[model samples]
Target: MATFVIVGAGLAGAKAAQTLREEGFDGEVVLIGAEEERPYERPPLSKGYLQGRSEREKIFVHPPYWYADQEIDLRLGVTVTGIALDAHEVALDDGSRMSYDKLLITTGASPRTLPGQAYTLRTVADSEALKAGFAAGGRVVIIGAGWIGLESAAAAREAGCEVTVVEPAPTPLHRVLGPELGEVFAHVHRRHGVDLRLGVSAEEVEADGVRLGTGERLPADLVVAGVGAAPNVNLAREAGLEVGDGILTDAALRTSHPDVYAAGDVAESYHPLYGRRLRVEHWANALNGGPAAARSMLGQEVVYDRVPYFYTDQFDLGMEFSGDTRGYDQVVIRGEELEFIAYWLREGRVIAGMNVNVWDVVDDIQRLIRSGGPLPPQD
Candidate 1:
């Protein structure tokens, strides 16, 4: 039996191993991760799980028993230090080497760090520590107003902590939802008693507080940083794979080497629909990309063209966004305030849609984007 090895045992890697078995591949499967914990999803690390609304076990992709039952060699707390593409082997930190007939890299990404002392949420431990800080219910100074920062602010506020968010942008999520919708988010946070200091940079982060570019110092009991994340592409780059913003792959998820494949946030795969390569670092991407790559690895025809999707919950607001919003010229609002659907259009074609406090229209939104149709007025 051929041995299939998966590196970085995240949600994508675990799902890939499961897919290999489900597709009737009677091969030796190995899942290796640098984290001692089993495969788990990351969303909860900043959402429900961080808010103390979700149990620890719920964050796991699979129970511990599942791996044993599936006869997979799940190696945790082990790092793949190097990948020797020519030899078809990976060098582990423990001084062990493993050979593979086929290899999949799902190494994922790491949270970007700030210049000084601050916490970031990327793993379970990170969440737990943040959760404890929130539970302490003191003052919190968040260094970004992006998704993670805003969500952490909400959690901190819920825990009765005095919260303040500092962002260099004119409004929260300015680059993402743009100015119009970004203002809406700003309104919500401000309404919920958050001190949102917009258009100012966090010049310095100390253990006690944050200093702004405006020369104002905001004291804090705890600091949380949510700048963004960068894909873990060192292994692929060192192995001589074609890497750009991430490991470059085709629509089939095949990397520069035929015997090696990539998926999830680490893989910048060609998107047939958008006519460009995209690296979507969202739960939906990993949830679906893994299985797609597995099928492709089994010599099945595959085109990974799923629409980008993500959801967020903060305070009493819940929102879902779908499709690509890049290069949109217009944003159309269908409803009013919090319970509305917003559409991003290029010329006359719908490119993306977001429903805030609205219900059950993601399918319609995605269909409209895929159709690239002109908005039919009067509905």
Candidate 2:
């Protein structure tokens, strides 16, 4: 039987292995992970799990016994040290090597850190620590007003902690939602009693608090740095694969090497619809990309052109975003005050849409984006 070796057993890797078996691959499937825990979904870590709304068992991609019953070799607590592309083998940190007829790399990203002991939410343990700190209900100073920062702020506030969010941008999600819609998020957090210090930087992360660029110090009991995350591409880079913002892959999710494939946060794969390379780091990508890569590995024709999708639940506001924001010059807001459908248009063509406090419209939003047409006039 042909052996398929999968590295970095996150949601993508776990799902890929599951897909292989479901597709009748009957091959020697080995899923390896550096983390001791079995593959689990990460969205809960920053959302429900962190907020104590979700139980720990809900995060796992599969039940603990699923792997053994599926007849898959699941290797936990071991890291893939290196890959010998010429030999089609991967060396493990445990001083063992495994050969594969096909290989899939699903190594995810790591949370960017600050100099001090500021916390970042990426793994289950990280969320557990943050949850405990928030439960204590003291003061929380989060640097960076991105999704993670804002979400954590909401959780902290719900836990009765004094929360302060510092952002260098003019609004919370300026880079993603742009300034206009970004202000809406800022308004929500501010209204919920979050201290939003916009247009400033966290100069220093001290033990007691954070020092602002304008020479202001905010005392805090816990500090969180949600700056961003960088894809773990060192393994792919060292293995002489094409690497840029992430590992370069074709529309079929095949890497530079024929036998190697990449997906999830680490694959900057070509989008047939967008006509460009896109590296999406959202949970939806891992949930879908893994199976796509698995199908492609099985020599099936695949075009991984699914529209990017992600959602957030914070405070009383729940939101879902679909499509890409690239080249969108105009945003049409159909409603206001958290009950709205915001459409991003580029030269009168819809490119992306976000629905806030709205439900069951993602499919329609994605359809409109794929249509690449003007927003339909309401009757």
Candidate 3:
């Protein structure tokens, strides 16, 4: 019997297993995870789950019984010690070998550790620890003002904790949103009573607080580091797979090895739309990439060219961004920060857009990006 083995039962892996069955592939499906708990949604771990608006079990991707009900051979708390590509087998840490006709690696990414009392937001346990740290409304000095850092700051402030956000850039998310739009977000945090510190990094992370490069030492009860994450590509690198920033994959999410594939944060798959390789570590990518790769495994020709999209919720601000914002020559704002639509124009063509507190226009935003049409003249 042909067996399809998927390592790392994160959102991507779990969805791929489900997709395999949905696509009429009746072969054996094995899903493995290093974490003992069942696969769960990660976005809520920092937002709703951390804010007490959601339950721990509510964030799971599927019910505990769903795996068995779907006839998936789910292996929790199992580690893949090695992969024998020639033999088409994966050696487990428990000294067991699983044969595979096709394999998918969705190992995902881990948070980049800084030399500080930092906490990451990738897992349920991590969220719980963050919440416990803010239990007494303690002073929180969080490094990195990216999505994770800002979101954690929001949750911390909601829990009545004093939060001081430190970022090296002039504004938050400067690399992604650029300075103008980034200023919009900076104001949001400042309006919410968060101590916004910009253009400086931590000189030292001590038990009491973080010493800044600007000769200021902020007292902190809990120092959370919401720095960015690096793709977990060590396994693929060790297996001699082609890796650049992340596991290199073709348009169909197939790795260099013929029988092995990669997806999610770990897979820097080719994007036909952008004509470049991208590794998007967002919920939407994992939600869509899994099924796309599953179809490819079943010998279906696919491009896997969905426009990159992601959303973030901080306090009252809800925003959805589409397309890549790099190298845009023009940026037009339709309204002010609170409720507005920002467009990134590359030579008059609308290449990227973000709608803040504007409801139900993501489809329209995507259409604009796909059309590559010039934005209409605005005063």
Candidate 4:
């Protein structure tokens, strides 16, 4: 029987393992992970999990017994130290070696750290720590005005704590949502009593507060760093696989090395829809990429192509988005009030859409994209 070894027990690793079994692969599958806990959803770590509204059990992607029943050897708390490609074996930190006929690297990205007094929200432990700190109730200073920082600020506000978000950019989410939507986000945050600071950089951070570029120190009880993330490509690089911003792969998710594959946040695959190499760090990507990679590995010759989609729920708002926003020509708005939808157009077609508390038309918008129809003019 072929032995398949997969590293990192995150969404990508778990989903890939499940796919292997579902495809009737009667091989010995071993999954290695650095984290002690079972695979859980990471998106919730910054939102519902941080708000204390979600239980630990509710966050698990699958039950604990699921792996055993599927005949998957899940080695939790085991870290991979090295790989010998010539022998097709992986060395573990615990001084054990495992040989594999095929290998999959799904090691996900880690949160970018700050120089001083910085907290991140990438893991469940990180969220637990942040939650405990928020329960104390005081001024919190957050660096970076990206989605993670904004979501953390919203959670802090719900806990009745004063929050201040600092970003060097001219506006929040300007690069991703463009100026108009960025401005709307800034307004919404300010209306919620959040001190949104834009075009200001944090020169230094201390336990007591944060120092701005203007040499002004803002008092803070807790400081969180949500600048962004860097792909975990060290292993792939060490194995002599082509690595750029991430592991470079083809449309079928095969790495430069034959008999080796990668997927999820760690794999930078060719995106047919975007016409370029892209790395996505969303939950949907991990879930979708895993099965696609597995099928490719099984010689099914399937090309991984899907419209990028993700969602975020915060402060009674349900936000859903699809497609890339890099080259959108215009944005069309539908409906009125707080509940509405926004469609981003590119080359006279609906490239992306976002709905905020207006899910009634989500199906319609998806159908329009499937039909390749032009988005309505912005009014």
Write the number of the candidate with greater TM-score, choosing between 2 and 3.
Answer: 2
Candidate 1 has which clashing residue pairs, if any? none
Identify the runs in model 3 with alpha carbons over 4 angstroms from their true place. 376-379
lDDT of 1 by residue, 46-119 (tens): 89998888999999999989999999999999999999999999999989899999999999999999988899
- In terms of lDDT, model 4 sits at 0.87
What tens digits encode model 2's per-residue C-alpha lDDT throughout 280-316? 9999999999999999999999999999999999899
| Alpha carbon deviation, residue 255, candidate 4 (Å) | 0.8
Error of 2 at 178 (Å): 0.2
Q: How accurate is candidate 1 locally (lDDT)?
A: 0.93
Evaluated at residue 232, the lDDT of candidate 1 is: 99
Q: What clash pairs does model 4 have?
A: none
Higher-lDDT candidate of 3 and 4: 3
- Where model 4 places Cα greater than 4 Å from the true spot, the runs are 360-363, 367-379
Candidate 4 C-alpha lDDT tens digits along 207-272: 799999989899999999999999999988998889999999999998998778899999999987
Better model by lDDT, 1 or 3? Answer: 1
Tens digit of lDDT per residue, candidate 3, span 1-379? 7899998899999999999998888889999999998988899988898899987888988999999989999999999988888889999999999899999999999998878567778888999999888777889999999999999999999999999999999999999999989998899999999999999988888989999998899999999888899998988888878999999999999999988999998999999888899999999999999888888899999899898999999999999999999889889988875999998989888888899999899899888888866766472
Per-residue error (Å), model 2, residue 14? 0.7
Please tell me which model should have the higher lDDT, number 1 or number 2: 2
